[model samples]
Target: MDLNISNIIIASLGLVGAMIGGFLSYKASKSATQDSIKAQSEIYNKTRELENRRIFENKRTSAKIIYIDFLNAIDEGLNIVKEQKRQHVGRAPNLLPMNTAYSSIIVSLSEELNPEELSVINRLYGIMEKVRHDILNLDYILGTYDHIEFDYRILLVEVFGNNYKEMIETNLEYITRDLIVEKIDREYKKVFEKLRVLGELNTYGN
Candidate 1:
């Protein structure tokens, strides 16, 4: 009976040990799973951060290019205006190319841009549109009545007269090429300042 009791005791001890081992194993597995989940969460957050940075950089780079291109277009348009004045005749070519660049800027980073930047850029575009429309109007007049005989000045007076020229002058004075360029420089400086602060402009060349 003592021997049997000893065997029974040994079996019970073995069973209890097995149960204890199983509990520890379960706890270890749970801890490992929690650690794995935590690691994945951290990795996901880092990935998201990297993605956001990339997108912001792309927008900034695009904005820089657009700003430069638009300024160059303004320069070209100014040259055209000077040429028109020197020649004293001929219709101005459209400034539509600059307008297109502005459109691209709006599409790419409209939401990202500060409200004041948006307003200034849009106002610049509006001025360009007016200039383009005027150029087109002049082209239409020249095309439609090129054969008319008279001094170009007299012909213009006869065709469009004081009212049209006065209106055109007013529009031109309000949004002169110099004014457009000045505004662009001012607004671009502000934008670049912000980009510099954010360190967004540094990544542009690469």
Candidate 2:
């Protein structure tokens, strides 16, 4: 029970020490919490970037596959036309028009497409659509006229001469051996090269 100045000083020092320790503990805990939040934010950002890249890759692969398929179909159709022209008699060959995959794929990835790519795809799509429409119109025209078992296209060619195949050539030149085919082939090559440069190359060989 010695209430001297030394005892009072010791008690005061102990209180100050406890307060400083408590403040330091609070500061450490706050700093740790902030660091954890920052780390979580960084992880979230990285995850988003990875997901975006994956989506872009998938779209690119899909576009390449679709484009190549359409190109193959065009080649096949031209070959069919050539074969039919050489060997066909009586009935006209049924030439199925190309699908709308070109437009569909382009629309799906519209957000990431550059202006040149977009323009190229749109032009190609337009050509495809116009060709499709022309084929349908030709079918209608042939349907209206009655003829023998001969191929309606051959009949039309005989009836119309050079003017008859104008639309067909414009639409079919991409896949045919006609003189116009070279120009269309060059256009396709330009577009495909651009796609390759954009990192949208397909797994399938050219």
Candidate 3:
């Protein structure tokens, strides 16, 4: 009888030890799984942050290049208009090339921009195009007469003179001394402001 009781106690202790060991092992496995999940999450977050930073940097660089190109086109256009004004007898090839360059930049900017920025840029471009047309028409009329007529002078004053004055008073700067250059400068300012707004929105979105 004594031997049987001792055997039973020993078996009971063995079963209890096994249960405790199993509980400890399960706890350790759960902890290891949680640690792995946390490590993966940290890695994913870091990768995402780096990608976002790269995208932002690329966008900023592109914007700067476009802005510089726009400024250069405006400067070239103004120089052409000034030369035409001074010579009074010839059509300026400079204007055509500058216009082409400006158009290309506008197209590129439109592709790069979001819808809101594109809309503003388009409106500004349309306004500048009308101004350019007016200048070209006036140039033709002046060339035909070899002198400015009253009617053509009136058209020029209305389209270029008054508009230029308004732009200057509003703090816009032109690339040339000629007032007609204000047309391009004002339009460039509008584009710049719209781009700035778009950039802010992009940053906030990110």
TM-scores for every candidate against the unseen true structure? 0.55, 0.55, 0.52
Weakest 10 consecutive residues, lDDT, candidate 1? 147-156
Pairs of colliding residues, candidate 1? none
Tens digits of per-residue lDDT, candidate 2, 72-178, equal 43443344444434354323334434456666667666766676767766765564455455445555433622221223334223322454455255554343333
Overall lDDT per candidate, in order of appearance: 0.54, 0.54, 0.49
Query: Residue 29 CA error for candidate 2 (Å)?
Result: 1.5
- Reference-based TM-score, model 3: 0.52
Candidate 2: residue pairs that collide: 90-149, 90-150, 90-151, 92-151
lDDT tens per residue, model 1, 25-143: 99999999999999999999999999998977767766666555444445445345333443544543443454355566566676676788777556655655555555455545436
Model 2 lDDT at residue 161: 41
lDDT pick, better of 2 and 3: 2
What candidate 1 gets wrong by more than 4 Å, as runs, is 84-113, 129-206
Residue 14 in model 3: lDDT = 91
